[model samples]
Target: MVQNGQVFKILVVDDEMSMRELLEILLLKHGYDVRCAESGSSGIEAIRSDPPDLVITDIRMEPVNGIEVLKKCKAVSPRTIVIMISAYASTELAVEAMNEGAYDYFPKPFNNEELLSVISNALRNRGEEQSVSDSREGLLYFGCLIGESAPMLKVYETIQRVAKTGSNVVITGESGTGKELVARAIHRQSARRDRPLVIVNCGGVPENLVESELFGYRKGAFTGAASDRKGLVEAARGGTLFLDEIGELTPVLQVKLLRLVQDKTIKMVGGTEEIPVDVRIISATNRDLERMVMEKTFREDLYYRLNVLHIRVPPLRDRREDIPVLARYFLSKFTKDLGKEIHKVSSYAMDILCNYEFPGNVRELEHIIERGVAMESSRIILPDSLTLSMHRRKEQERTVPAVRSEIPIENFDLDKHMAEIERRMLQQALSQAGGVKLKAARLLGISFRSFRYRLLKHELATEDELKEE
Candidate 1:
């Protein structure tokens, strides 16, 4: 369609001449600059020579299928949105096409109005996405962190600024906010990138062993010290050492660590000589170290040493705009690991994710998407596929109205009351979902299998009517 003095170009690819002509006429009638490709190979060539604003390709083309064409379009021009159509559409093929970067998939004989609407919306969104990308070029940092939110951009700028120095850094954030990732980014961007970067969780190890873990021990220094052993600090010599949960370090261990940070040398346990070492210390903590210092819990002197350069990772809830990017990233990651074909997350599912206050932060989002990919049976992740936290579930359950009691407490028939309420909910959910059991199941936050079983239990539908979804 023409907008802002520029006409949107659309390429229609199909083996059937009639189908191609029909699409070309339809698209041209809508004012789109339309081109026809009789085969997927030609479609790929057209995309390479002059990438269109959008592509409409049939999935079953010979020599090169729509999935291949989609991949080539993404490779050649990532902004070129693709829509896949197939007369013989299957979930597997749809999933593969979506994972390969098709904007949407349609079964053959699709509604004309729906197809046109999708095309219009896709191009509009493509324009908006291009604008956003242009505004925030190089949004991804260190090939690991992803976001263009204000909080994340600030973090990226700080990483770039501090990564050049050898000063000790303290990364503060909630437990799952990716503090370790920020530490890794700092180390990767720092001068010691070529050297070893060792990570140790201060809270994971026992308090008794933390001292020896941070400073090497001599042979026969203790009963279990069978031979001379190098500590994690020594292992990180000439590079960087990431101490996660630095606030969890015991007072005595903190003193030992403070000396190392102060002197740049460590005296092995039961050894007289102090060995000099060069390393940048990056410590991360979810706790309020400042409060702990006031409370006389954490050592202030050590805190100052690690706080020379500070970075605070914003929680996922604070950067809701990043949820879509993070969710897609995790989807791509888990799909390959689980050998699942799922790629796209439904708009409804994404809405649920973006609205969620992820108490567990980015790590929780990763787990949610990973679980979604594993649980999803279709090409797109639906609301029913997402399994949020139990706390959130409980919170949702609280929002649901309590069942009204019609009988006196002494005469209450608990079982019958519960059954009646259950039946009523089932009917209401079914009605609201427009007789679609899957949607009804999602509405009630129940599984399709469970909904079907309940339907049988309550005689809501016959066996034939409630067959496998």
Candidate 2:
């Protein structure tokens, strides 16, 4: 009733024609476009005819149960959400329906109000999802913040819980870890979602103009202020203002920002009038704000104000298991963007990516995929497609004597060929570096950290321990 077709286009499927008609009449009277199907086969046919936005079908129906209908809908037109209804919504039936992709299930003689509310909420969420899907460029980030690590799961759960609230959020993570994504996601899910979401890089803005940029400027505010200009805060009214690198804000700017948070008002530069504003603040910083506060560079009070809710994005190395998922996602994105035919990564290439510690996190992985898509000739991507600097470092590591403790061949009877290669490589690296462990690691093209791990794993002795012996 509020908006036509803007709401869910619903199809009512049931063995009883009376039930179908009653549902259709009830929904249509309330301003929903409703259709009726008396049998499972008919419902499936109607779905194939033109998929409805939502399907409400009875479970335990003749010929095809709700599960079959749900599965067919999922396979045929996955976007159409399915809701199951039955005379008895037993646990088993509900589970089966849900497992087969039913969005929800209602028992016969449903509580009409609850059913309506549930339907409305589902429809609203579906609308939100569709809107997000449209905005997703080539690459997509759910929660915009990417991570599949256990630590990241906690972060995702927190985002979902806190996004609906109007409270401020402070995101902390190393650089290139997608802090902006988290801020954007919170804005997209917030009450002010319909409003504009603006971003300001606090570190890059000049100290003298930071205040003016954040809180508008009058025509005569400064030498370059030719006309009245709205600041990011005013522009982001009723929405969110993301402040990146908050640790870089000058002491003077910090006080002003804190005032805005406390009073929900901003005074344009060189203007006496105070403008009442409603803007949610989402701040992020890679720097140690706590340490900065200790050094008196940042105000402790301001830190507390921005830290209302905190979400930390983990480094990509910590979530190696998600590398392939992200890689494939990016590959598909770039393939379409670059118009390349590359479809997949070779297993060996995948192994290299998973094991490598991605210092630049998701952003770096995206670049690698983009590069691979450009360089790949075969339909499948190979390791050479990625200019992974780390692999060169790995080979250098394999050459170090400290890479593995030298076990006398007789002392460490091992696979003949593998042991022979290990001894020869170690000896060559030692000879090349004059047996200097640090130099040996460098010649081997590996970091001391990586060499250390390999040495211990291989039960190889370090030259330092050998000298002590």
Candidate 3:
């Protein structure tokens, strides 16, 4: 590989001498043209003097920081890829770096294999970006999703590979992560593109009616069965059946679904006939089905059958690099749809979007952009037009008074006190919402997943507690 003349020049910037030496040795062993800088100032100078293909910089440095280095690199060499590293990594710092155009971020004491993989990916992506730039085309878009971020590129690759296969697929991700869009993409790319793509919201169906909804029922099957009805499975013959929120299927429904998945046939309610169906199964869930299987809530056989091929859609916060492109894409789409004259998003608005932790993922971002487009009177969207949840969070944060008590700082346990206060507030919210998690989350002005995570963190609600509510 080294003789093939594909080596990439890499620059490592760290305040510690040992770190610089270690990274240089590691990169050199891998047949790379490696350079090292012991300070952020020197790294900036080197970048301006002779830009490398990639720069690996420590976030915490003297006189200048990694964020500054990343800014300088972007300004001097727009094509150069920069990866930020730090022993002290926070969501805020990571968001800042990504918004400032860092290629990726990694915490200190990183795994060798993972770092190597990231470096290889960064080099490969640099080539792809250069090619796109040469052609004057925008970011690579697959179906409804538009992104050139590494995570999104991987997702696109996976979709292309799996689309041609007949294997069952399980798409896992947080809610509003476009799991359905992925299912549609797979169907559009598959051999069954011309055929029906039936979507069944598994959670929306009533438990008592799920069986009949999935399997056709005879005219006299039940009290309300005035006419015979074909089920979602039969409707999707020779096509794809996308089961959204598969985890919501009860144990009995899971067993029935498992049998259908295993046999490719369904038996209708009050019907002795076993109707064969030719369809691909693609299921999506936001819940942890593995834990559910272990807990005996979901069937293990069903889980395995649905998980023949898995695609995980990464949450939006993890792929902040794609926010600008996505925001622009949404802006264009909504403008045309709504017949607005909006042409672009202001840099300040884009920065706000990039810094936000989108608990609702891509769907939330799209909604925000749509709202912004609708609200904006001018061609450009400003920061005020973009009403994000983070703004609400900031307002809420400002309302809380500072710690003012007759207690010494050394003797006071501020963290513990805050935890107790949070726990009590959550409990009160749940009580006020009548133990409904969604309502409680809304009452708290937070996302349901965020509320659920806090509930898990504080051990506030057991499975049984949730069920009872």
lDDT on C-alpha atoms for all candidate structures: 0.81, 0.74, 0.80
- lDDT by residue (1-469, candidate 1, tens digit) is 7766779999998999999999998989989999999998999999999999999999998888888889889999998888888898576787677667777778778778778977886777665775785456435689778878899989999999999988999999987888998999999999999999998778633454566667878888865566887888999999999998898898878888887899998888767788888889999998999999999999889989889999999888789989888888788789989998874786546766877777778887888888888888778886666884412531342222236655543324578679878887887787677556788899999999999898888866659544422
User: Could you give candidate 3's per-residue lDDT for residues 67-163 as a string of tens digits?
Assistant: 9999999999998988888888554676577677776667778777668876785577565565675353335445476777899889999999999
State which candidate has the highest lDDT. Answer: 1
Q: On a 0 to 100 scale, what is the lDDT of residue 456 in model 1?
A: 88
Candidate 1 to native Cα RMSD, angstroms: 17.3
In candidate 3, what residue range of length 10 has the lowest lDDT sum?
393-402
Clashes of each: 0, 8, 0
Q: 1 or 2: which has the higher TM-score?
A: 1
Kindly indicate the candidate among 2 and 3 with the higher TM-score. 3
Candidate 1 achieves a global lDDT of 0.81
After TM-score superposition, the amount by which residue 221's alpha carbon in candidate 2 deviates from its true location, in angstroms, is 1.4
Identify the runs in model 2 with alpha carbons over 4 angstroms from their true place: 1-147, 392-469
Order the candidates by TM-score, highest first.
1, 3, 2
User: TM-score of the candidate numbered 3?
Assistant: 0.57
Q: Estimate each model's TM-score.
A: 0.60, 0.54, 0.57
State the lDDT of candidate 2 residue by residue for 1-469, as single tens digits: 3443465688888998788878877888878878888888888999999898889999888898778888888989998888788887365676556556676667788767667766775677575675674344234346355445687677777877778888888899877778888888878877888999998888643465467768988897765567888888989988899999998898888888888998888888889887899989999998888899899888988888888888888877777767877888888889999887765665446767877766567887898888888987667666667875536422233221323456643223346447556655654564466445466678889886665554544444445433432
What C-alpha RMSD separates each model from the true structure? 17.3, 20.3, 13.6
| Candidate 3: segments with Cα more than 4 A from true spot | 1-140, 392-469
